[model samples]
Target chain A: MRISQLSAASGVPIPTIKYYLREGLLQPGEQTAATRAEYGEAHLRRLRLIRALLEVGRVPVTAIRQIIAAVEDETMPVHEMLGTAHYALATPVEAAADDDRHREALALVDALIGELGWQVTPEAPTRAELAQVLVRLDRLGRPASVEKLRPYAEHVARFAREREMDSVSGPREAAVESLVVGTVLYGKVLDVLRRIAHESESARRHTSGHPAAPAG
Target chain B: MRISQLSAASGVPIPTIKYYLREGLLQPGEQTAATRAEYGEAHLRRLRLIRALLEVGRVPVTAIRQIIAAVEDETMPVHEMLGTAHYALATPVEAAADDDRHREALALVDALIGELGWQVTPEAPTRAELAQVLVRLDRLGRPASVEKLRPYAEHVARFAREREMDSVSGPREAAVESLVVGTVLYGKVLDVLRRIAHESESARRHTSGHPAAPAG
Candidate 1:
């Protein structure tokens, strides 16, 4: 297939494909002639994964490059590859240095992990991210304790372990591509679903002759 | 209390508070003299909310302004205010005006809402957002049916209905501020929890001598 066909099939535009090729996000197609190149099925699959990450996941271009590198390295074990993809997609939380609040939040996060019996990598960015949100919630006086986070943790763990792991099965490249794409898309799916749920609940409460608020 | 006191109390810097005041994301403190303004407890609360939206939610500044305006419009009913805030925070999905894929997605979303007996607002941005995600997932060959999304929808809806609604209590401004802040931050908290859960699951599978993948 030519570049044009790859573009048509993948729903990606020609110029954008060119941009990706220039940036080495998409591996170069076989040079069939002076200015024409032939893209294969692998190219198409890779292109779709890149677009998914860029558009759906909103992973930065640089991060996408890192994820691609990690995925293509077949020598990497599945667990480490998932971690690389995870790290690439999740921006690190900016935990302040030498801050008492940050230390307290870190301790809480570690404690939560211990209590939940979740063997998160010592430096999984989500740990810091969770800690940061905990600190922020505490500041707001909402104060989400470990117990408060347990429900969310259990919900996602069941989904990831039961559904997500089962979802990633196929030949090596295909499995990896889908895993990388699913990693971000599934999260977005959850986010939109949550929003819709809130909208439904909001509508239900208001329509049931429930006044929205005491002062409203 | 002066702006300095507000900053100290909120842990926000003086210049950032000034910027928020200039942008009207924060209402101006009372003018006391040529170079002085007095901020009350309300200012501190609002400042905390604004930072949470900015840092935790990563909401664009313009969107945050719109959310602030909607939340401040005390006359608006709770449901409508929530709808307004939802619209403000959720960047609209770009559903192509005449794309068949989008049309099909829209129909699917409507059907899903109907099946769930959810009375979502007609123009709820999340409807389009959810539809778009379904389309994207389909293109990835991971077509998530309405059934596939049900579990996530129920999970989030339960959280919103049972916990989130009840969490919003207090005087009017306090209630509204917390609601707006919680709306975004809680989502972040859930997101990190999901990631942590995945990390834990990955560890469990790998440490128990599960091969990460076939060729890895």
Candidate 2:
């Protein structure tokens, strides 16, 4: 396929496609003439992944570049590739400005990790992100103690082990796509549904609240 | 206490705290003199929440004002207040660019809501959000059909009914705090934990293959 067809089929504009090529997000196509380069299914697949990350996940361009580098690095171990992809999804939370609250939050997070018996690295950004949330919750006087969050922790573990991992063993591109889309977007799927559930439960409590009435 | 003390207590800067007040996210303090005003504990609490939403949740100032307005409307029913809060957490997804893909995605979202037995409104923004995520996933050739997403939908429902609704029974201010923080910040918590779980799973698949080995 030519660049024009790729844009038509993928619904991405031609100039934006050129921009992606310049950004090294999409690989260059086979050179056929002075002004034209031929693309294929591979280009289309890559374009789609890039859009999903940028549009739905809202991942930063720099992080996406790193992730794409990993995807193109076919020789890289799948597990290792996933490590970088997961790490790149979140930008680092600013360190607690020497705030004592951070110390306690960090301790609380580490203890929770210990209780859960999960083998995670000490410096994983996600661990720090969790600690930051607890601190924020506490400052609001609506502190979510680890015990309060324990149930969620357990559910996440099971979801990751059973469902999220199911895709890890597929072909590299497919597997990477699963990790990128699943980690960021599906996390969203859960968030949006949780809101719906909030609505349903609120309706149950506030109104006569029959069972899940289908939307008319 | 004065605004300066509120700033100290909440760790938000004086200027930013005033911005919240001007934006109507914070209620005005009692005027003590031509140039001085006194704040109370409530001011402190509101400041913390504003910081949490802005710094951590990254909710826009406009949405924060709307949410704060809802929060301040003490006469507002809890269910109604929550409805607005959840809706405010996300801006509307662009109306599918008139792409035909949107129709199928919306149908799928409605079907999934039906299958899960969630009583959500037809016009709920979260419903539109779920549809958008699915559409993005499909474009990546990683269509997460209803079945694939069913488990998450069920998990979310259970989490909402049992855990999230627990907070709705609190005081109005506290309840609104939970809705805003829980919907936005805790959503990040889940996203982070899911990443951690991915790390552990990848470690399990790649390395020593131990259960969650504790961080050093």
Candidate 3:
């Protein structure tokens, strides 16, 4: 297939496809002639994955490049490849050096991890993210208790298990691609689902004459 | 206090505070003279909220304007105010005017809502969001089932209930502000927590020499 066909099939514009090729996000097609190149099924699949990450997952182009590099590296362990993808997808959370709030947030995260018996490492990007949220919540004078977050964590673990189950079936690279796409895109899915559920619960409580929960 | 003092108090830079004022995300301080204005505690609080929404929640300036408008509207019901905030926070999902995938996704959303006995309206922005995710999942050949999503929804409902509990404690306007802030920022919190949980679960399943779950 020519670049035009790849664009048509993938529903991406030709210029965008050319851009991805230049960015090395898409592998270069076989040069059939001076101005002609041929794409293949793999290119189609890769293009779709890139679109999913960029549009649905909102992953930055630079991060997507890193994720794609991991995906294409056959020697990278599946687990490590996954770690690379996850790290790329995470928004870096910055904290002030030597800030007490940062210290408190880190301690709270450590305590939560211990309480849950979760096996994550101390340096995971999510640790900083969790700390950032905790610090901000504390600043707002509504710090969250572990008791409040435990059930949510348990539920997330279950969802992760389900996602893992969903991603482990295909061939190695394909499976990794699926896992990367699912992890980033499905996070958006979960966010939307939760919002919908919140709307439903709010409607039931406020609009349907089911007496609103008493104000605290 | 002058705008500079408000900036000092909120830890938002003077230029960014001025930007927020220009954007109408923050109300003007009272004009005391030709070039001097006196800001009060309310200005300080509003500046903090603006920063939280922008920096922590990652809400766009335009959406923040709509959210702030809803927050300041005294006549808007509390539930309605919350609806405005949620709508603003949602990533708009555009579907073709006559697309089968769109229809199928809508059907799936309707079926899921009926199955769950949820009270959400058909027109909720989240309805479109849910449909969009379903459509994308289907395109990726990993269509999510109601069975898979139900547990996640249940967990989301629990989180929503907890959020409601937290928001009902303060004065009306303050409660509304708290609800808005919590809804946006806590979504980030939940995302980080879920990522952490996924990392932990991945480690336990793959890195600890435990037998991995069988691929589906």
Best by TM-score: 2
Q: Which of 1 and 3 is ahead in DockQ?
A: 1
Query: On a 0 to 100 scale, what is the lDDT of residue A175 in model 1?
Result: 56
Candidate 1 lDDT tens digits, B1-216 = 988788888889989988998898999878999998899988877876687667655678987887777668787777776665566667567647548888788888887777777777678888888888788777766776778777777777777787777766565455556666666778777777877777777667756654332211
lDDT-best of 1 and 2: 2
Docking class of 3: acceptable
> By the TM-score metric, which is better: model 1 or model 3?
1
Better structure of 1 and 2 per TM-score: 2
Which digits, one per residue and each the tens of the lDDT, describe model 2 over residues A55-89? 76678889889888888888887777877777777
Q: With candidate 2 superimposed using the best TM-score fit, by how many Å does residue B46's alpha carbon deviate from the native? A: 6.0
TM-score of each: 0.75, 0.77, 0.70
Interface RMSD for all numbered candidates: 7.9, 3.0, 7.5
What DockQ results do all the predictions give, each relative to the true complex?
A: 0.38, 0.46, 0.33
Candidate 2, RMSD to the unseen true structure: 4.6
Descending-DockQ candidate ranking? 2, 1, 3
Which window of 10 residues has the lowest lDDT sum in candidate 2 chain A? A207-216
- After superposing candidate 2, which stretches have Cα over 4 Å from the reference? A1-76, A209-216, B1-76, B208-216
Give the top-scoring candidate (DockQ): 2
Please provide, for model 2 over B101-213, each residue's C-alpha lDDT reduced to its tens digit, 9 standing for 90 to 100.
88888899888878766777888887778888888778666777788888887887777877777765566666666667777768767777777777877787777544555
- Candidate 3 lDDT over residue span A151-198, tens digit each: 767777776776544554355446556656666666776788777877
Model 3 interface DockQ? 0.33
